[model samples]
Target: MVPPLALDIDGTLTTPEGTIAPRAFPLLAAWEAPVVLATGKAFPYPVALCQFVGIPERAIAENGGVALVDGHLDYAGDPERVDAAVEAFEERGGDLGWDGVDTVNRWRETEVAVSPTADEELLRDIAAEFDLAVVDSGYAYHLKSPDASKGAALTDVAETLGHDPGEFVAVGDSENDASTFAVAGESYAVANADETAKRAADRVLDRGYVDGTLDALRAIRDRAKNGE
Candidate 1:
């Protein structure tokens, strides 16, 4: 069996404008492996997509702040800690909040997701005030748990699912996913990924979005077939 896949949804699964690629749904539907949709998306989408793909039982969301399985939600940080970080940012008149990100992304229980338009340095400074952590999702700056992260969660899930970390393929195109890349046995970055993200990958695809993903997957499958 192929190593389980841990994928980021934004630029890797969707187009640059954040629309789901035309090939995405079908590609996922036909997959026959233990794959986790790892992303910064809050909810519903994670759960909803999981349902659409026959894995409605588990998801990784909120940049690693949340883990959902069998409709159960697990959080890495306490609400009080998250709220204090939020409050610290709010002390600056809450101007660091992002409005351009997906509108429904408001229910950030474990972290506050801010748009790129927000002051990155200021946001980091605010999190520092309360000993919180701020990480970039390529598109947003998230104030989140000091320890729980996309990479850590991916590794955790892979282990729980009985796969060695070396048997996991982590894919993404953002900063939040950098951690996932570091922990997984193989890492792939789409053509549209940022420089930092691309640098972290073991392989760089030629295409973007799901097309690029499918292309790379085919090569991996071929390699296994050839005993290479």
Candidate 2:
């Protein structure tokens, strides 16, 4: 059985400053399962990450808005939900824009990039008012569609690969990752995860940031291999 692994970037895979740890490369090189980077960063960021991680083509980009498979732009899902969400944002006095959506490698999942300087606080307030889940990535904010989520994106990839959802593990460190953790067979959070994320996780690592995240991945991989 192949186990799929979904990893979050930023505070999870890299430090808060966006540097991938040196220890990570070797471990990633040895990974046997399909590894997906699930993040809120845009194509350029994930494209850079794919170069660094040596998986330059196989990745999900734009938070499920785009899907890249085997170095190609395989799928770009409907933007109806995101479009509606954007309209709602505008109605709330928030201006959000996307240059274009594509499945570019850089991070863990398919993602759509909102303007880096988008007004996050206002977006969050609007999201809350509309009962939507707002993901704040410091540099940008995302309003997830009811059907578009990291978990849903991972499920789509797993299905395409003929893997069971129950065989996959997910690890993340923020509110955006809440759904990702919730849908995984086993889920984890770094020690520094927010209250909501920590509460949603099945386990919490002893460390935080890249160190904690790498350790958590190793633990999950080992546990699966050993049937622990």
Candidate 3:
């Protein structure tokens, strides 16, 4: 049988310009097994992606701070802790670098996302001070609870869905996806993947972006056919 799929959005499912790949929606919606959208993005983003793709609403968002399976919601991060960390970051002369209303984090429920233009080192330092974790998703820097990791969220989601976490295959392209790579039965890092993701994955695909994801899915199908 084909294993479930856990996919990262931004750089993995989208084109270089950050829009969803034209071929992605139909393929994911038609996949034989469950498809879980896993990312550092807020809850709404993945939920919407699943809806528009015509798939079940299964997602792990906010770098694992939040998970939604079917209609049930689960939360791992404490908003109070994230609020404190964001306050400390601002007090330390840190600018989130958003040009206007900071829409990047306006609807986020668990973590604070800083633009790539901000000081990553200083943000990491601030996150450490508050006992939080910082992960660079290539598109942005996320400050979140250390306990909230994609791997842990996958495990929780898998149990809730009546499957083992190891029965899922994960595809991604950033350091934030490393934890997921660790938990998945098989993991692939696209060509443009960060070094962390490359190191964590079982194989690094030759293609990048959605092309690489398509390749990974093909490989999974081949493996099932071969009884691997």
Candidate 4:
């Protein structure tokens, strides 16, 4: 049987330029086992991704602050603390690093996503004050509840789907994906992965971005065939 999959979005499924790779659609849709999209992006983002990819709507969104599994919605991270953290950040003369309307976080439900262009140190400090954690997704900096993490969401979703967390293989490429790497039975980081993610993964692929994801998928298929 094919191993279940938990994949990160930004640097794993998308191109270096951040657009979803066109090739991923058919492969993901045709896969026999469950495919869960785990990302720091908002809930709607991954939900829509599943729809477009022609897969079941299984997603861990907002850095695990929110999750949707077969129509069952679960929420973690505290939006109140996120609001406080944002207020503190602004008070310290920090910008969420967006001009005008802050669309990056407009539709976000449970946590706040800040631009990587913002002051990382300041964001971390404010997050600490608000009892939140800061995760650098390579695309953005997310301020979220310490209680939220991709690993936790994966565990929950796996159980709900009648599988063990260790039955899934994970693929990702950033600091935010580290939690998932720690929990998956097998984990791969793309060549472009951040140092934190590389150290956490079971294997680091030679290819980057979408190519790396394809490589990981091939490896998984080989493993299944060889019964390894």
- The segments of candidate 4 whose C-alpha lies over 4 angstroms from its true place after superposition are 226-228
Number of the top-ranking candidate, with lDDT as the measure: 4
Instruction: Assess each prediction's global lDDT (C-alpha) against the native.
Output: 0.76, 0.67, 0.90, 0.91
Model 3, position 166: C-alpha lDDT score: 94
Q: Give lDDT tens digits, candidate 1, residues 158-194.
A: 7667777678788888778788889888999988888
lDDT string for model 3 (42-122, tens) is 889999988899999999999999999977899997779889988888888898898978778988998989999998888
Query: Model 2: residues >4 Å from true position, as ranges?
Result: 71-133, 224-227
Model 1 misses residue 29 by how many Å?
2.2
Model 1 lDDT, residue 122, Cα: 73
lDDT rank order = 4, 3, 1, 2
For all predicted structures, in order, the TM-scores are 0.89, 0.75, 0.96, 0.97
Sorting all predicted structures by TM-score, with the top scorer first, yields 4, 3, 1, 2
Error of 2 at 192 (Å): 1.7
Q: Please give the RMSD to the true structure for each candidate, in Å.
A: 2.3, 4.9, 1.2, 1.1
Instruction: Point out where model 3 deviates above 4 Å.
Output: none
Give the least accurate 10-residue stretch of model 1, judged by summed lDDT.
96-105
